[model samples]
Target: MKKVKRTTIYDIAEKLGITASSVSRALNNSNQVNEKTKELIIKTADELNYKRNTLASNLRKGQSKTIGVVIPRINQNFFSNVIAGIEEVTYQKGYSLIICQSDEDHDKEIQCVNTLINQHVDCIVISVSADGNDYQHLQNVLDHGIQLIQVDRVAEELETLKVINDNVQASYEAVSHLIEGGYKRIALLEGPQNLSIFKQRKEGYLKAFKAYNVPVIEELIVENAWTKELGAEGTRKLLSLPHPPDAIFASTSDFSALGVLDVANAMGIKVPSQLGICGYANESFSEITSPSITTIDQFSVYMGNTVANLFFQEIGNNDTITKPKIISIKPELIIRGSTKRNG
Candidate 1:
């Protein structure tokens, strides 16, 4: 097959009987070229299907005008919403984004960062995977003089720009709501403790019980119950105990809470009456579930918008000086049928 040649400024210049330098200035909208000549050059360039090489153009300005985003899963509602939010602002700022999914693998996360660095992306926004123990990949980004931002799940040890949800407070509110609804025995389906967010959520659960003077049942608290299958298994085990919990806080995700609800149905237990369910992330299906689940709304899209806007505000001005910044968004409790035992 014959290769189609890309249209360049030289081609436009040759068609117009002018030097390539004049065409370059006209395309760049530099004041050195007159308006009439610029108009003619643009028109001819458009007719020739000319497209500016953004990679080369950004190199000249010492910027890529591009951002790299790394998330665990693109199909998940929370991460996808965040990406949409980032794109909304980046699009208007004349920037582009290169997105990657680590699939919750540490090695893949490192590879994604290295790829972004090699591409010379101006900034990198990441939500570390569950296995992201060593943060040398992030340090490498800083060493290369690239801006780094962490969202959702961040490494607290690293000082960088971060936009995250207040997991502790949110979990506190969710558990507190269950307690207020007159639940004495509340079980917690927790995530991996290594991740800061899960640890904070566990802290919040414990704090709520402490505040209420309620003794925590050690058997009720399950570890690594982050997935639907695990949540179902945990629920079965908890419900089978001699002194079973009347409420469960699936603090890991709505998906886990969903598993609890499914198992409860199969076991002939009623939600909010026999057992209340509260989940995190307030996934869309939470509202549609029978006896819709009570959950915490993380404002995922707003979090994403905040990340993008923060980058533009801090770095878009071309200021060399920058300081470590942290923005924490407060999540709200959406009390639905699953946890409304009293009302």
Candidate 2:
């Protein structure tokens, strides 16, 4: 196929018998160009099918007006909702987004961040991957003088703008609710302890037990059970114990909670009567299950909006020594049939 050349400002200027600079200024809507000449240039450019070189133009302004986002999974409801919220705010500001998924791999997360840095993005927003233990790549982003915003999962050592949920309080409330339901022995399905969110959740669980004077059983707590299959496996192990728990809290996610419910059903264990279940992150399926799941609502979309707004607000400030700010949104506990044993 024969190549067709793209029309440029110079071509439009030649057609209008004017300088290329005039055409450039007119195309950019610069007031330096008079109305009459601007109209003529625009008309000629339209006739020539001229398209402005946005990349070149943005480079001159010292910014791409683009933000890069790195997330663990793009298809997950919570992350997708967060992306939608970011788009809602960024779109109105004439900024574009470059979204990349790490798929919960640390290496891929690093690659995504490096790619964003190479793109000269004005800012980078990220929810770190599960396997991430090193943050030198994230530090590289700051070394290049680009704005970095961490949301949800974050690297605690770095001092940057962060938006996160009050995981500890949310988990505390969930466990307290289970205890209040007269469930004496409760099991816990926990995520990777390397992540701060999971560690904080565990803290909440322990705190709840202390507050109620309930003895904490070490055997009932299962680690690395953030996935559905893992949760199910954990549940089976817990149920097989000589003294089984009456309640289970899947503090990792609703998917994990669903796994617990599935295993209980297969084992002929009735929920809220013989067993109780609670989950984190109020996934869509949580409410539609046989017995609706008691879960925490993270307001993921609102968190995304807050992340973008924080970026914009910080970018506008001229102070170079701005201290890192952290904004924590409180998650709400939604009571449902899964844990409503008394009612």
Candidate 3:
């Protein structure tokens, strides 16, 4: 491969017929260089397409000025919004982000973490995959002296900086709303049990039932039904049962609820009137659906900004070891045609 040489300050100095020291002082915005000379040097540097070596500069200061972000899926609405939010704050602070997708695979998640460690990033922000249970990779990051922060789907055991939604409370609210709206048999579409977020959601579902004195039906609970395909399969089986549920709470994501909607449409079952549905993650498509799916707003972008700001606040003060912090955001239940039964 051919390497195109990068334009450096020296190239600008040569082009502008000036000493390299003068060019360096001007680039650094130092008062040592006169205003007129600084202006001339900057213009010449811009003309030469000169780029400052941020990586080298940061290395000299013993910091990377870069953060490594590991997410389950970049294409997902929630994760994407969070990344955008993190970028919004990090960009203003002159920090660069290195993003990696785990694809919800444990081995791949490990690889992503290892790669980030090798890169020597100042900090790493992660949302563990559904299949991730062991977090030696995360421990290794901390051992390597890299600041580690967990967001959303995180490992509860690891004592680190964490930003997440109160899943149990959110799930409780969603189910409570359904029960209040007259849903007799509310089914649950669950994700991987190993993940703390999913477990908390399931706990919330059970808690709601207990609070209302509703009988728990073991058959109505579907495991590993976090995705649309699995959600659809689970719904197909549920609706086929003689004692089908009157409502379904897709506690994983909005996509799963969308799958429930699809299955209901194909089976000619009426929504809200016949089978009410609720989903987590307030995706854009949720509002556009025919009846509009009732879902939870996790404040994904805000969550991301919070995560980024936390990193800056703690890391800036050199206080990573002093405390283990957990920031929780309350999720909101959005009522839509899918869950609104009142005529």
Candidate 4:
């Protein structure tokens, strides 16, 4: 048996008794070609399984019809949902996606950006890693004449299309919810300060304290306690203090809140009775935890769809709408058992 060679325009043109140039022009919807010829060419091309070499066609057209997406971790629930949303839109627009994960490493993130650039992707969407501070990699994407879109964990310095949640407002609302539930002396577990998301959350926590006329205690604020282990470590320290906090806000993520729950449970401290807990990024597990953790829903899937649409709007429309755009999605606070006082 002979191996089948990939179908080409020449094959289709030959079958239709036409020149290859005619087939090419028709396939490209050139004004020089008649509409009937274009329809016949497309129909025959489809029947012959003549898959146009997207790379070569894109090169000729000067548009790849492909987009690159970079995230901290692909396995994370939030990032995964965002990717799904991006794919939903890009697929509809006949575009392809190349996804890369940075694993929270700045060097790896830089390499991922370079790889995407090398691939000549039309657009590069990114959610910066925790270790990211130097944004030369993100800047390089823009310098390469590629559309740069930052979503979720974005860098503030770069003027690009940014689709993000209202982190400060969401955090403030969550903290306020706890306060309304009679939680005072609320301790906070913060993420890495380098990322704007964490910094905004920290600011919200501080603002909530100031609004309530509660003195901000430096001792209760733990730095870089974004991980489960770090959250546990921070909880141990906070709970050990002679004036231990009555509540804890894991402003990092749900994983950190899980850590707080475990530590409190291990120490025989009843949730909502002794301590109230709140988390960010409403993970699925947050709802299932013994005392379901109250959290902020960032609408990860909706955020992703918004990011994809931003790119589609820019690339699909052949215009010079060059103004840098910023879109902030408001997040909702989900109340659960962990933060509720009355049974």
CA lDDT of every candidate? 0.93, 0.93, 0.93, 0.91
**Candidate that would win on TM-score:** 2
TM-score of 4: 0.88
The C-alpha TM-scores of every prediction are 0.93, 0.95, 0.90, 0.88
> Candidate 3 residues 300-343, lDDT tens each?
99999999999988866854357788999999999999988885
Q: Least lDDT summed over 10 consecutive residues: which range in candidate 4? A: 314-323
* Per-residue alpha-carbon lDDT of candidate 1 for residues 32-54, written as tens digits (9 for 90 to 100): 99999999999999999999998
lDDT for each residue of candidate 4 in 3-97, tens digit (9 for 90 to 100) = 99999988988898999999999988899999988999999988888887888889777888899999998877888999999999989989899
- Candidate 1, RMSD to the unseen true structure: 2.1
Model 4 Cα shift for residue 11 (angstroms): 7.9
